[model samples]
Target: MADLPELPATITVDLDTPLKRGDDAIATLTFRRPTTVVLLDMSLIQLGLVDMDVMRDLLTRTSTVGLIGEEVDKIDGADMLQIARDVSDFFQIEEFEDLEIHIDGDIVTIPLVKPIVRGETTLDELRLRRPDSGSFRSLSLARIGQMETRSLAGLLPRISMSPLTEADTYAAEPGKQRGSLHAFLVASICTLARPGAIVDINVAPDRQQWWPGSPLIDLNPHGRTQNKKHRALVPVLPALDRWLRAEYATYIALSQQDRAGRGWLVNYHGRPIQDVDRAWDTMLTNLELPKGREWRSYLLRHSLATLARNRGATKWDLEGFMGHSDGSQTEVYAIGEFPSVVTALEGIVADMERLAPGAMHRSRTEHGLVGQLSKGDENVS
Candidate 1:
């Protein structure tokens, strides 16, 4: 291990909204580096902010002023995510090396090139066949060696036949069946388990609610749709309508009992899936991505937001679609209330499809979008 930094590293955060605990209202939170015992038990960097419950638990255990669970729960979503990021940064070690390239027969091997740390794995290499004329489809020669993570994620899967499949991700046993559906679900919707639950099957003629995302944080066990404030009908475009129609047919075929009380259109052994961390890792392992490349559902949100903004979405349109509060008392009145949000989303998805084909559907292309968003894939969640 690299040398440890000074003990008790602290991050002082001023909250946009003060949370009340008993007689005291907390306006700022001071987070100290978790104890060695806490770090040993919890992999904050691996878990990151994707798991809000874990972050909350860690904060309660490490706060210098001692916040109760209620106060921690009341913390703003953006602030909480930022704190988790700051905490995770403490675990990063300074490590770098020059990229290595070699040629062997028909394949080219590049090792230890731009190593990245994600969870416990550090991906640092990539092996690919020597590119031919066909490999240059829609890509220039200059872009080949300078491919970003999303490009690599989308490109490599086409070249490689992943061991994991959409069905295998929901297999019954560990050593038995495994697939990429879990990863796909998370990547597609930015939420865990409860697949198809967020979709509105009862489509209206004037408007089609095609929203398939939840809040950046999901701690509700009952489901993410528990809060009425978070519910809104977004207009559906042609592409979204096509995707929804396909999913709707399958959704209606399942018996209510098969939904596992979660109304999940997707399930494993007729049971609702509670988590996908293991399945996500399995999917990553199948992708054969180089070590250190972190994959999280949060990246999907980042991609959508970035693309939507680039497509000229207003801040309210983004805030509405993303289910984020702007610290306005009237923010609750506008969730999914913007008709333009859907238009922005439609454009965003189109941009995604153009950038990374087959992201929306399996038949569309051989490529997958596990990492095929813009450079916004960086951990800003």
Candidate 2:
């Protein structure tokens, strides 16, 4: 990367203040395997060192898709099956055949569910259902008799997707371009916290618990994306609160002002975003790189966990961050550790809120994202 002038010259800047803390925190990362350069703050600063550059590369992107295809250069069959299982579990599919995968844009959904679910993915059969309902997978939900996500991966008989548009079908490249801000928005959210799903969320003006939420989108009433364990908001930084308020304000304004009355926070042509995957799909399709390049939807999630671990997050902190609810049924273990976990996660979450230093370039005006928020523009283009 240093060989090319297209990359900015970071060597001149002195990143002292945060680097000092990072240097001190390096001790915390000793337990991490392979002894990777653990940047306490992975923000951009040209430290004028070969190691920093390598570390930045390591911290920013981690492969979520581990399998490599033999010929077409897609995810390997095993990896694809693994992902298929994740998708199925996250969406609460009774059978693998129930999944309705689509790529008209970068989206995956399940039309079989009530209200038709969509979001990013994860989980197992025991982990599939809500905590209040039952702890693990049960035969009541069986289409194939108490099947697990992994078991069906190799033998899923049914999966479907929304029909493609005639124009998309005919055109060589029908997907549209998306702004970098959108990429940062999604990446930052997933990077900062456990993401149940990456689907669209409805944040209320005052906030209230709502229902029938997508598991991937935080199985909650108000439906704001939340931590799996604490149920606190993901992207748990102060800046997230500010930006989210801005988003909610824009949504309220748009819904109130629209002549056609579309009540979507994000929309296309006076319509609600029926399938939230459009935004996700657009972001990926717009990347100007080789198809099936290094990044994938789940990379942000993996990157966050790995980076957090590198920065000294303990196992309990990780459990809180990841929303792992599978411990002993008693409340004693979590209740005792919750406070410490929250404190440790606070710093890691803050680091995630800040975009990977130098990876994103913005003065905030290129896309008029701020302008759209300030003016309450409905289109987040």
Q: Which candidate is the best by lDDT?
A: 1
The alpha-carbon deviation from the true structure for residue 297 of candidate 2, after best TM-score superposition, in angstroms, is: 0.7
What overall lDDT, based on C-alpha atoms, would model 2 receive against the true structure?
A: 0.32
lDDT of 1 by residue, 1-381 (tens): 223334336778787777777798888888876544554334343344346766777788888888778878888888786777777655544432233366655545566423446455565554454333333444444433543233344345333211222222233224443323432342343221122333222222112232222122222222334453443333444443333333333333356444333223233432345455566566556555333332453343554455345445667766655545433566546434454545555544443343334444423211222122212221211
CA lDDT of every candidate: 0.44, 0.32
At residue 176, candidate 1 shows an lDDT of: 41
Worst 10 residues of 1 by lDDT: 372-381
Cα RMSD, model 2: 24.4
Report the lDDT tens digits of candidate 2 across residue range 51-126.
3343333223322222122211232345333333332232232444434443322223323222212133211111
Would you estimate the TM-scores of all the predictions? Answer: 0.36, 0.34
Candidate 1 shows a clash count of 12
